[model samples]
Target: MGITDDAKDALSATGEKISRAVDDAREKVSDKVDEAQADAKVKHAEAERDATKAKNDYKEELRDHN
Candidate 1:
């Protein structure tokens, strides 16, 4: 009976450790996804700014020619 109890305790501890590890991994992945999304947003904003600048520059050139 003592041996059986010991085995059960060990199994429970191992399960808890595995659960914690899985949770940690899930959190890390979520953080990375959020970081990637933020980076994409920044890139999109930069592209928009560049396009607006180009358009304005072209307009200025037309005015100068006239």
Candidate 2:
């Protein structure tokens, strides 16, 4: 015995749906990663700015003491 044309069609349709779902999930994950990367960059810049400000304040204090 052999499989019928209807069964093959149904299998093909299922495969297409699964592929689409996988692609959608992949896009969602990529978007989240991009957002996280942007957030990290902002945080790193803020930290650098804070550190520089603190260093300048310390240097000013040393000058005042001298």
Candidate 3:
């Protein structure tokens, strides 16, 4: 009975460790996804800004020509 109790304890400890590891992995993946999304948003904003600037510059050039 003593040996059986020790085995159960060991298994329980191992299960806890595995659970913590899984949680850590999940958190890391979520953080990476959030970072990627933020980076995509920044890139999209930069593209829009560049497009607006180009449009304004083109309009200015046309006015100058006229």
Q: Could you say which candidate leads in TM-score?
A: 3
Per-residue lDDT tens digits for candidate 1, residues 1-66, read 999999999999999999999999999999999999999999999999999999999999999999
**Residue-level error in angstroms, candidate 1, position 2:** 2.0
Candidate 1: regions farther than 4 A off: none
Give the Å error, residue 49, model 3.
Answer: 0.5
Residue 36 lDDT in model 3?
100
Preferred candidate (TM-score higher): 1 or 2: 1
- Candidate 2 overall lDDT versus native: 0.97
Clash count (model 2, backbone only) = 0
TM-score of each: 0.89, 0.75, 0.93
Across 1-66, the per-residue lDDT of candidate 2 in tens digits comes to 256888998899999999999999999999999999999999999999999999999999999999
lDDT tens per residue, model 3, 28-66: 999999999999999999999999999999999999999
Question: How good is model 1 by TM-score?
Answer: 0.89
Worst 10 residues of 3 by lDDT: 1-10
lDDT, residue 29, model 1: 100
Per-residue lDDT, model 2, residue 64, is 100
TM-score attained by model 2: 0.75
